[model samples]
Target: MDASLLREREAFLRRAKALPVVEKPRAVSNAVNDLGPPPTKRIASSVPSDLRSAELRPALQGKFAVLSSVVKYMKQRHLERDTHPLTVEEILEEARLHDTPQSTIRWLEEEVGLIVVTKE
Candidate 1:
């Protein structure tokens, strides 16, 4: 080996040996810390009876049929235009243009299995 290269290698070894060792930080238990305390039995027992009695309203069922029709129409329009699949935003915009309620749009996306295209 070259004398300069041998000296540089020795220097590197000396510097490495002089460096202080570091210990890894201990892992923290996140469940309790993140969620805070569990709900007390008294809090659980005090939930209102009216909440338990809540049932789906008949009006909502009709909205599903309307949304399905709108989605069908939107699909046909896309097919006619030879455009890419409708995005959630595009669907919502069409709904808004036709005066469909924001809540109805949300219900269609969340509960009625509306498929949306995401940006690639």
Candidate 2:
């Protein structure tokens, strides 16, 4: 092919390969308009001072009982490798599981104490 024809073909190919450029609108917002309202903060009620308050004692006793039941079960069932005493948190979790009934708690405490004494 001749150089002039080749040059024309290259120019046509270049024009075909080039893409059209377009400008997209930039996102813009006024600071005053964007700042519409301030966030609201809520304060929680203070905990009661009385340990035996209607809301307090039952929750605590229930938790304690639940934990005691769980701890006793763990000792008997060997749920974990550690044989150390159950922490308040573990007892609470167990209590949570057992629904922490007062009777269950008292029974578990008695049972656990007896088992401990027997083992010793």
Candidate 3:
């Protein structure tokens, strides 16, 4: 490297400016605490044996149709992988699905016939 180039680089480094100090953001002790307590899940004690799809509200029935599509999608994806059986639990739990309805499990077991909603 040339001595003049090195001297110019050194001079530039000496004259370099710095950004003004900014206060750091307050650290949360627990990030989850900021969100408040997790909402309590409405744990279904038991799904009625005689619950009918038609008995459900129109909007809810539409959601069931969507849920049915999800089950079919899950089943199709599973079938593509291998001949292994896909269950209601897998469909519910798929794609990090947490908000799936409890009654859907029974619907899956009885309506879709994949089972694994509960073990006998």
**TM agreement with the true structure for every prediction:** 0.35, 0.24, 0.33
What's model 1's overall lDDT? Answer: 0.68
lDDT of 1 by residue, 41-120 (tens): 75564657775433233234457655766667687777788576677667656544344556766777788878777878
Please, what are the lDDT tens digits per residue for candidate 2 over residues 43-113? 76586656336454334555454545555767764756756556434554654553445565455557544
Worst 10 residues of 2 by lDDT: 111-120
Candidate 1, residue 43: Cα displacement in angstroms equals 59
- Kindly report which residue stretches of model 1 are placed more than 4 angstroms away from their true locations once superposed: 1-62, 78-83, 95-98
Q: Which candidate is the best by lDDT?
A: 1
In candidate 2, stretches whose alpha carbon ends up further than 4 angstroms from where it belongs are 1-79, 87-89, 95-98, 111-120
Task: Give candidate 3 regions above 4 Å deviation.
Answer: 1-63, 117-120
- How close to the true structure is residue 15 of candidate 3, measured as C-alpha lDDT? 70
Residue pairs clashing, model 3: none
Q: lDDT per residue, candidate 3, 61-90, as tens digits?
A: 554664656757777787788555545666
